[model samples]
Target: MFTTKDATTPHVGLLVDKVEDNVDYKKEDIKPLDKLTEVGFDIDPQTKNMMRGLIKLAEKHSVLIDPSAIFSPVHIAQEDIQESEAYGLF
Candidate 1:
């Protein structure tokens, strides 16, 4: 979620829900989602564009059906955990 090459602030940060406390961040402890939303991210514009493209593809293919509905903080974590366990993302 971050890189030394990150611009403006070579730091990667995120705001998560209270359940975020249950996750292993590998470094910093979890912070509330409101914090993350407020702190936000400063990813490279190129990466943002690339992500937009990928999101578009997913939306068009129904790969992320009702994505907004599943966008709940808890579900986001679940999706990541599932994908990691399923494909050894950990």
Candidate 2:
């Protein structure tokens, strides 16, 4: 997942499995996951810090998991997003 500040609201972006035209296209030829925002996980400051620690530990041990498994799309409040942005955290 990735975060973007381009929009007026703060939201998370997710990378989904690749969709095939024959199998996954919607009525207008849009992919199933395209522009979809079903749920969100809010990452508070403490949680973010904890996650950072966990990542550090994993790196130290050389057991870091794949990035794709780490997080889902999260929708944080504007203020929190701003704070996170200030720290260049994602």
Candidate 3:
């Protein structure tokens, strides 16, 4: 499982069969998921919200999960929601 946490959100993790190097890819390397490609995958609403797009890594096409999406299901107090220039990047 891979776990990630952000300053504004709780920690989130996902179970995986294996792990690989933390590499980067160019924007053009990613493709949007089509309906056919999404079939049979029972994605939770929260999980779906976390999906960014599809990207090709090596020879395999993979789902690119956004870090922000991991915390989509979390409920924050209204008072906890603060606006700051630091957060504008997200």
Between candidates 2 and 3, the lDDT winner: 3
Clashes of each: 2, 0, 0
**What are the per-residue Cα lDDT tens digits for candidate 2 across 28-90?**
433222122233545454234323211112223111122322332245322243223333333
Error of 2 at 64 (Å): 31
TM-score of 1: 0.17
Cα distance off (Å), candidate 1, residue 34: 14
Could you tell me which residue pairs clash in candidate 3? none
lDDT string, candidate 1, 8-86, tens digits: 5654332322222132232223232334225464545433322311111222311112222222343354464433343
Task: Assess the local accuracy of residue 36 in candidate 3 as a C-alpha lDDT between 0 and 100.
Answer: 20
Name the top lDDT candidate.
Answer: 3
Q: Kindly report which residue pairs in candidate 2 clash with one another.
A: none
Every candidate's CA RMSD: 15.9, 16.5, 6.4
Q: In model 1, which regions exceed 4 Å deviation?
A: 1-38, 53-90
* lDDT values for all models: 0.30, 0.32, 0.56
